[model samples]
Target: MNHNEIGIEALNQGEIEKAAEAFTKAIEESPKDPVPYINFANLLSSINEYERALNFFQKAIELDDTAAAAYYGAGNVYTLKEDFMKAKDFFEKALKTGMENSDLFYMLGHTLMKLEQPKLAMPYLQRAIELNEDDNEARFQFGMCLANEHLLQEAVNIFTEVVKRDPQHADAFYNLGVAYAYLENKDEALEMLGKAVEVQPDHLLALHAQKLIQEAK
Candidate 1:
């Protein structure tokens, strides 16, 4: 098997050392190819070796400026480091290079949300949901973006879908409650907040919201 494939197999099998050895050999054999470097970078990133992963991603990008995987890897490293601006830049670059993946859209949307640019985040989050409708996290984030944009009904719809798909999603329930409250549906809000606290007893926000709604009643 090719060194890269062997390296991938080793990584998947959780043989870190063997995977590293195979990836190193793959890089040595194909220094000009960006794929091995990108794969190694991803492996390093997965293991929390951020600096090394960034270096490998940079090397891959230097080898092939159009390498979308390199840009995406670099974006992930920056995101893990909480450098949201840098993450957004690299993610945008990846998109500019025609890298279209649910993860790419999700990360870019999440980065925008982190930057408090919810208006800009909406389309990317929507794209992520479109690409993977079952991604509850993406749907939750999309709901948040919609709420931030003052589209309470839309936010409620997304959050409802999230909670329906994953009943144990306390955060989704909490947000759904909040959206309902904003829409002046006090009964539904109380019900959802109660469900949120039931699902996660220590969900402080949900508890607090439920108490306030009860007091209001």
Candidate 2:
């Protein structure tokens, strides 16, 4: 069988490296096929080889102007590099090409946050949370974004949801303590900060919160 067919079979079998090898051979066999390039880009990104992944993403885009994933993948790489503006631009391009992953919304939130446009990030972050409430990372970020925007009450809600979803997440607990402190609920702040310390013994922020509370006493 041709390498392209082998690649498809291997990918179907969840043998990613074998699939990548097969696609590499397919790229050699049919240099014009964008599929091999896309496959290569996906695999490289999975392995965190951003530079090589970006090269293949560009190749896929060159071969297929209509490929949304090419732009999305590139956006992801730029996001990893902290190039929020570039990432946002690429994400927008991908959306124009019909990308609709909730992750795209999450990325938009991230990009906007880095741009210090926390208010602008809210809608996208809210959309992401609505799409995937179980996405604790997005929820945590959303809470932080809200807190930064002076929407302390809303921030409290988001962080509360995060702690509810994963009680073991001490950072969320720590941040929740901060949110409560902002609200001037000293008792709740102390309690949550204590919970954070209980969950993560070495949590500096929790310890600091405890110290601050003690100093206030």
Candidate 3:
């Protein structure tokens, strides 16, 4: 089989080192093969070598300017760097290249939230949920984002859905309690917070939330 094809095989097997080696060989054989560069960048990212991964992604894009994986890699690098604005830009570029990825939209939403542009983030976050209704993390994060923006009722709704989906998700119950308190629904807050403590007694944030409620009364 061709070197690129071999690399793809190694990639699917999760033999990261082998895949990288094979992809490197493929690149040496075809210096303009953006596929190998993109695949290699993904491996580098899994290893937490963000800077080097960015270089590989750039190489992929240099060979094929419209490469979506290249921009996606750059976006991930920016995410690791906590440079949310740059991450947002690269993710948008990746989307422009027709990469209709739910995770990409979720990342974009998160980045916008980090930038304190929740208005822009909401639609993307919602779209991510639409794409994958079972994404509890996305739903939870979107709820917190909305709560931070004073959309307490909506945030409560989302967090409630999270707990319903996974009752063992203590954080969801805890955060839902917090949102309930914000809405002055003290009884519901206490009920959910008590459930959170039952699920994870050592949850420090939930403990703090309880303390605040006690102090409030």
Candidate 4:
């Protein structure tokens, strides 16, 4: 029906060129509307055209200053560019614009973690988990942040939950082992590390950890 609707359908079908054409038409029809610009920006971001995507997002913001999606899109582009600090700033701005959701919280948390601000990242990650408990990647990252912050037991608990949720998660097992070792629980560390190696026989870190623990005994 509408160009915007057609663009969204084409985007969902992975027809990027068609989607772009539809979105361009939508923009020409409603030049002052920010939605098409934001949608186009999202498509560009998905294709890794970070600079052009950011420019379109800025254009959306210029049209509607309260457009939270534009800020979120800009933040996602910055994240792809590995500019974690700028990503954090835009994500924060999105939140201030009343765009509060699990994804927003997760991105902010993840960016803070990348910046090595684990303490600052904890609350956001916690909120993200509260909003969406099935995000094992977020859970694993939060566990790592806990371990880095010296919260050994809590880290172990989180890692244990991760392994329980996905038994084939070799990295979760390895992290659990590391957390146990930090707590001086050598036996548990060995057990978890052994499981890690069992799950992924080519896991060099797990093998090394196992060797170190065995020699220390």
lDDT by residue for model 4 (1-217), tens = 8999999999999999999999999999999999999999999987888899999999999999899999998998999999999999999999999998889999999999999999999999888899899988889888988988998899989999999999999999999998888788999999999999999999999999999988998
Where is the poorest 10-residue window by lDDT in model 4? 175-184
TM-score of 2: 0.87
For 55-133, candidate 3 gives per-residue lDDT tens digits of 9999999898899988988998899989888899999999999998679889989899889888888888888999999
* Per-residue error (Å), model 4, residue 211: 1.0
Better of 1 and 2 by lDDT: 1
Q: Whole-model Cα lDDT per candidate?
A: 0.94, 0.87, 0.87, 0.93
- Give the alpha carbon lDDT tens digit for every residue of 1-217 in model 2: 8787787688778788898989989899889888788878877777689999899999999999889888988898898878889999998898798878689889988898999998888888888888887788889889988899888888888888898999998988898889888889989999999999999999998999889987996
Q: Which residue ranges in model 2 land beyond 4 Å of their true spot?
A: 1-17, 28-30
RMSD of 2: 2.5
Where in model 4 is the C-alpha error above 4 Å?
none
Q: Over the stretch 161-207, how does candidate 1's per-residue lDDT look in tens digits?
A: 99889999999999999989989899999999999989999999999
Per-prediction backbone clash count? 0, 0, 0, 0
